[model samples]
Target: MSGHLDAVLARVDAGLEQSLERLYALLRIKSISTDSAYKAECQRAADWIVGELKGIGFAAEAHATPGHPVVWAKGAAQEGPHVLFYAHYDVQPVDPLNLWRSDPFEPTLATDAHGRKIIVARGASDDKGQMMTFIEACRAWQAVTGSLPVTVSLMLEGEEESGGKNLPPFMEAHKTELGAADIALVCDTDMWNRQTPSITTMLRGMVGEEIEITCADKDLHSGMFGNAARNPNQLLAEIIASLRAPDGRVTLPGFYDDVAEVSPEIKAQWQGLGFDEAAYMAQAGLSIPAGEADRSVLEMLWARPTCEINGMIGGYTGDGFKTVIPAKASAKISFRLVSGMVPEKIRDAFRKHVEAMIPADCSVRFTSHGGAPAITVPSDGTYLQQALRGLSDEWGTPAVITGSGGSIPVAGDFKRILGLDTLLIGFAQIDDAIHSPNEKYDLDSYHRGIRSWVRILAALAV
Candidate 1:
């Protein structure tokens, strides 16, 4: 093992140029899944991945999906704590493209204001660059030691930017091949800070619902109806308003029934990180807390369940004002739930709340989108400890455990379908501009990321 580790490190140091070239080739594919015009580009990216994996002596293929293809690969001798590595080949659409300093598809190396060298491209840091970190690490191992420290199955989906509809079915069909993993390695999260590595301990769940309220057969003239007819717009607004109180507590009965309070130890850990609430608000051009009265800003974001009105439409929204109450009013609402809160229960409670708020003259219709429950990994897991020790050894800092406010549905799916716990470790930072204009990945991040994964693999294999 010591000799193999030495050989892998030597290979990584020698393959730096080849690694960057491969990343550049991948960045040139323009695999934007959300855009129909880029369908072929998505396939091209998948094909490229297949070639890369096969070049590394893995049996790889690009399997067709309804929208895009998923690149699947497996190394030889699949035994001994096999790991399923998950990543996405698809990148977000580069709209508002003019904001970028260079073409989003044209990868470039540049230095940032902080003197950190970075890779500028559409999917540079989001998944492509991050995924390559692990892949390149494995490549180094295979090139030097002739095999990876552990058996690995690589699954790179081309539709993560869109909903991963094809993934669940694919996993079901290939359960024997994909489900043999003892654990999953997910490279989709960020470090706590530029210098501080983070292992994401929790991820908030999500529930989305679209509600439509109808009060009349057709649009009613305000002057003609006056107070005679009911207005669905008013009813819908009132119902939404009633969901949350002025103090930011959700007003639905039993809404907090299953919510677990933040532990004092965890709270102290978060406090010690020295999060600047005022600075965070200032960046968003605000000055007041919009969450529960007693909770800190960090707690509000990472621990609390929130009711948010994603979108709403009613009456006339065109150029001219129309003095008529529309027959129907519709809204798209969502909830970010923490651990212990079931999405089904929340959806049911929301439906009940809307129904109870509706007048006899009005009718309410609810449509629920799919949802997943929150997840929290035990901090003391063996894999997590290995990750912490590896990252600390590589970066010279203690790794932090943090929770993200957003949902990563695939993480939940991995736990449900494969019964595999995922370790969320990556080198992306908070200001990487992922899913936004001018996305980038720091060059130092890309280089050190490879080294970090090397150390992690070595630790895990031990």
Candidate 2:
């Protein structure tokens, strides 16, 4: 197995430049799915990927959705377990063009201040560059073994940057075809750091709610009814302030009931990672960690649940101050949920808490955007061990299992809808600046990323 892997990896090394050329080609297309002006470009990107997959011996095609087209491909069935790979083809819009050092659509290879070679472009690291690593790996494996070690399927989306509404319906319509795989591989996360490779084992979920608190039927003048009239703005501020206690814990009833405590083993592993809380604070221009008591910044971010006010708009203030008391105030609240906490339950608790705080004359209405429960993959699985070993061999460092604070809805969807666990692995670094101006993917990340996938595929084949 080791000798065969070595041969395939060598093939990957020999063809690294060609792999990069292919990535550069994909990065050049302006497949910004959010804007209709780029709709044709999105289709062009999908078509390009379909042709590439076919050339690599996969039966591939593009299927049109209500929005952008989805690209799916399948290689010839092999002896090992089947795996489904997921990535997005669409890139984010490159606004504030003046901030960019070069044209975002033009892929440029340049060195950073630290002397790291980087490919600069929109969507370079977000998914385009990362996804190409998997494809290039498959290309190398086919060149060496004339086939992939395992049966493989590719599902590329065009609306990941936008809201992916078509994906759930499409997956529902083709559940059997996609769910046949033993596991799903998602190349959409960052490595722990520049040198250490990491696998995301847990992803936080989300619950978005918009609450509108209504007081008077119309705006009231403060001079006319300063002390007598009920002010929804004040009421809203009070309700929002009551969400957390002085100790920085959520005050919602049963919010902590289902949230499980971090295990001693996992906590110890995270502690050993040498996480610099002070430095992390400095980057955000802060010196204090404000969250649940006694928890480290990492634990607060990854392991614990959180309630945040995403947006609040009620009264008026434009150019000058308006002394009128607004009739209603509204706020958009989002909850970052952890495993073992149900989204609906959290939503209900939040609504209950808000209703309890409303005065007799005031009325509160809640609007739910959406909610998804958290997902956690078992660390002891055979496939996980294979991936960890493969990554360790490629990077010469033990792969760290980490939890992500941000939620990838598709990861949870795979488990809930298809009964399949997903392995989230990627070569992106923290400073990739995805979705921001001057986005980039390290050249080393692109090269070693392909090699790592090669090793993982060889191991999974066993």
Candidate 3:
């Protein structure tokens, strides 16, 4: 019954140091879920989250999954919407350690080249720091009013960075408890820039596959078979080349059959964002625009579907030339699906296209890795408008609705499994170098992130 907005904001400001200490404790744990050696560490992270939730007066516990433990918690029941908050505890593997200035597990506060203080760690900006924003906000509200403003349930995942294959089934098993929510909040994405706050509404989905082609029983000497033997490597190369047209369209049959055009209103809003195409390409050491020829960089990323060859393997030369035609060749491919595309249909079309390309004498095998559909939040929803107002209030700048090119599988899973719409409200920046060495989360982002959620919670309360 009490709305302690000002007092809650003050509590967040006063308790910033303590919040950092808690986040540092989490950042210190080596909870990389992809590797087998760090399985115990992942469990430790999950347990620590449960403990934190319980300390804050939530009925919280860790549930064992086939892969890693999932931390589930519920707050005091309230009158407003029952919202489910989703975040991941496990981080990406910190490889190429030499590229880092300090230990990846050691959380350090240092000033960046732009003179902003940053928290440097493995999971600083990806999900750990981002997720902690929500937890810390809850703590502040609970301290100020002795209760949260709305009904809250949290589902923290540990296998997000490692493909998160177990989460769909896990959600299926706990749908009654998890699916009772009115909406979902995911804090694992990025803001539009340093000065702006963003709520992501569009998330692209994915379909991953691997194909192998065989033209002979064994590797043949290039000199012996240079003119006679059919080379699988050559065949695979041609197929790969045929995938994309010179005009940057995929050749897969029916690939565009289900694709939908973005509304003109949305397109105008994106164009008004003042996106710096030059800077965007310069970040990746590229100067030319690739992909769809007639689309803007933002359009190519957020709206258009894409087919990319991730990897190709055929022959090898360790120290010198081997001059051998490999009997087999394989390629790893992935498709980023937009709103209207179906995963199975796209995969089937790709397979049929590949099959049509194969010669009668050669055989090909298809291996499917995983698939999920894209998610699009309604642009004119009431809850979305309220959250945007809250963010604008906290930042003193207008908040924007944005879309992401990358796939957060859990967002799609939340939609498909639990039948819930999610607000991908994140406080991370684009250049946080997440999933790479020397990752960092800005102090300003962390401090303002908590305040942003504080305002959002207040605005969402009935």
Candidate 4:
């Protein structure tokens, strides 16, 4: 097996330029899903991926959706474990276009200040570059051995940047076929650093709620109804203030009931990651850590639940003061949940907390955006252990297990609908600038990411 993998790595090294040309071809499509003008471009990008998969001997096709099309494919059946791989073809809109140094759709290579070669283009690091790494690896494997080590199925989405509302239903529609895989792989996350590879083993889930508080049926003059009529703005502000404690804990009843502590070994690993909280804060123009008083920054981010106020709106003075008590106020709030917390329970607890604070003359309404439970991959799983070793072998550095602070709805969907946990391993660095102007993917990242996947596929060939 080692000798076979060596041949695949050699094939990847020899075909590096050809692989990049393929990536450039896909990147050149203006597949911006958010903008209705680029709808055809998204379809074109999906077809391109399906064509590339066909070239690599995979049975691939582009399927229709209400939004952009999804490209689904499957390789020849193999004796190794079956794995489902996921990525997105749609890129974010290029707003403030002047900020980009070059055409967002025209991929090019440039030397960065760090003297490293980088590929500059929209969707380069966000996913086009990352997605190609996996495909190129499979291409190399097929070029060398004429077959994949694992039974591979791919779900290349076209609406990830545009909220990905169609993906869950798509997966649900193809549940048995897509869920037959023993595990899933996603190439949409980042490495811990350029040299240190990391697999995101956990992701925080979320629930969004918008609350509107109505105090009076209509606006009242402050002079005539002063101290007589209720003010929803003040009432909303007070309720928001009461949601958290001075020590940075959410005050919702039972909020902490399902929260679990990070294992000792996991906590030790995070401590060893040497994350600089001061530098993290300085990047945001802040001077202090603001989460749980007793927790480390990583712990607060990866292991704890949080209640955040996203936006608020109330009485307004367009040009000058209105001198009136507003009839209603509204705010959008979200809760970041951990492994054991249920989204519905948290929503209920929050509504209960807010309703308890309403005055006799006031009324409140709650609007649920959506919610998903947190996802955690077992640390002791065989596939995870094998992939970690494979990554370490390719990078010459031990891969670390990390956690994401944000939710990935697709991962939740996979777990919810397919009963398969996902291994999110990607080679993009933090400074890749995935969704911003001048987005790039390190040349070395692209080249070695292919090699890493080759090794992982070989290792998983049980």
Off by over 4 Å in 2: none
lDDT tens digits, residues 1-462, model 4?
557988889999999988899999999999999999999899999988888899989999999989999899999998869999999999998777999999989998999998999999999999989999999999998998899988999999999999999888899899989989999999999999988999999999999999999988988898998898888989999999999999998899999999888999998899889899899889889988886899988899998999999999998758977898999999999999999999999999999999999998789999999999999999999999999999999999899999999998899999999999999999999898878999999999999999999999989995
Model 1 CA lDDT for position 396: 94
Q: How well is each residue in 1-462 modelled by candidate 1, as lDDT tens digits?
A: 445776777778888888999999999999999899999999999999999999888999999978899899998863356788999989999989878899999999988898888899999998999999999998998888788877888999999998989998888788777888877888988888888888887889999999999999999999999688888888888898888888889987888999999888888889989899999999999999896888889998999999999999998999978999799999999999998999999999999889988888789888888889888887779988888888888889888888899999888888878777888888997789999888999987888889888888888877
Off by over 4 Å in 3: none
Tens-digit lDDT track for model 3 on 299-372? 99999999999999997647888999899999999999999899999999999999999999999999998998
Q: Looking at candidate 2, what is the lDDT of residue 176? A: 90
Q: Model 2, poorest ten-residue lDDT window?
A: 1-10
RMSD of each: 1.6, 1.0, 1.3, 1.1
Model 1 bad stretches (over 4 Å): 78-80
lDDT of each: 0.88, 0.93, 0.92, 0.93
Backbone clash pairs for candidate 2 read: none
Error of 1 at 129 (Å): 0.5
TM-score versus the correct structure, for each prediction: 0.96, 0.98, 0.97, 0.98
lDDT of 3: 0.92
Candidate 4 lDDT (Cα, whole model)? 0.93
